[model samples]
Target chain A: MIPSSWYLILSAVLFTMGVAGFLIKRSLITVFMSIELMLNAVNLSFVTFAHDWHAVKGQIFVFFVMMVAAAEAAVGLAIIIAIFRTRQTLNVDQIDLMKF
Target chain B: MHLALFLIFAAVALAGAANLLLQKHPINAALSLIVVMSSLAVLYLLLGAEFLAIAQIIVYAGAIMVLFTFVIMLLNEGVEEKTHGSRVAKLLGFPAVTVFLALIASIILSSETHLGKVIIGESITTTQDLSAVLFRDLLLPFEITSVLILIAILGAVALARKDEQ
Candidate 1:
């Protein structure tokens, strides 16, 4: 059997990579993808703990998380498209309309 | 052994992440993200969170990622412009990422709580147990999720629509 620690470690690495990508990438789409990566990393941990506890609450929570993610993706992509239409670019640094 | 499976999935996830990071094409990156999400669902199954595994595949790999792909296609963000940041911002990214990583590592390591053996001995699995609790005690959240989805739909439409003014 795969030790739970290995799962935890892999999750940690993936989460770190996601964070790094989010911080480094300037494109809105890339940032959005990094966010998804981070969420999946969290899901990995939640499942690991769920298995460990032999409880379904964690799994149930993951379901809710997925729902939220779906919602976020839909709305977030729309916003990104709107921004692209107005700004003609997806680079966060170049588009500073919201920044004061 | 399960270790081999874990290694394989971890390799796949890493490859997906790399593709997401390195690929210039938004569509390709989106596809890679789907691969990563599906591999994660498989991992969830191994962890005994079967419901979550299935939900992950359906919600993430199936629904959200497809929406992302559509947005990419609609925008036609074919070639991503190289990222450029101010000197300070460029300097800040590494430190910020490092600090966040360190914080997560410390939190995980410092926590002393250990999970006890809870695996059902061929008698019960996660799906049945989760359904029981979800329907019996946590019914409110179950219902609330629908409201959340509805709101998200409205929000997406409102955001996509052009301003009247």
Candidate 2:
């Protein structure tokens, strides 16, 4: 059997990569994609824990997390589109209206 | 057999993540993200979290990735001239990322010391058990969270549209 630790390690690696990407990438779309990666990484760990504990709570929690992710995506995309229209660009450095 | 399969999935995930990082195009990154997400779903399945696996496929690979792709397409944000960070930022970021990764690796290693053997075994792999717990014990938060998500969605749309008027 593949050890549960392997899955957790992989999840951690993936999450770190996602975090690095989110912090380093300048493209708004790329940043959004990185955020998705982070979420998927979390799901991997959650499932791993669910399987280990013999309880279904973690799986159910994953279901709810997925639901929230869907809604977040819909709303996030709309905001991205709106910003794109106003700025005519999606570069992170260029959009500084909200920055003090 | 399971180890071999897990290795394969892990390899695919790494490749997808590399593509996400290396490709300059937003759409390509989004597609790679989907590959990574689907491989994660497979990992979930192998772990006996069938409901979570299906949910990962549907919500992440199906819904979220598609939304990302659509947004990338909608914006027509082609791979414009690649923007480089300032020299100072690049120099600082390299050390910062290295330290961060090191810290995470240490934390993970420390946690491994306390991990006991997996206990659930093969008996807990059914959908019925998951549904029962979800519907019975966690029903309230489940419903409330859905409502909260709905409100967030509406707020996002409203915020995005308000500028048009």
TM-scores for chain A over all candidates: 0.94, 0.95
Kindly list the per-residue Cα lDDT of model 1 for residues B51-151, writing each as its tens digit: 77788888898889988988888888866666557345448877887787777766665552453332323223556787898998899998988999999
> Which sections of candidate 2 miss by over 4 Å?
A98-100, B86-90, B116-124, B161-165
Compare the candidates by TM-score and give the number of the best one: 2
Q: Could you list the CA RMSD of all candidates, in the order they appear?
A: 2.6, 2.3
- Computed on C-alphas against the true complex, the DockQ of each candidate is 0.61, 0.58
DockQ computed for model 1 against the true two-chain complex using alpha carbons? 0.61
Per-candidate Cα lDDT values, in order, are 0.78, 0.77
Among residues 3 or more apart in sequence or in different chains, the pairs in candidate 2 whose N, CA or C atoms overlap within 3 Å are none
What TM-score goes with each of the models?
0.89, 0.90
| CAPRI quality of model 1 | medium
Alpha carbon lDDT at A39, candidate 2:
82
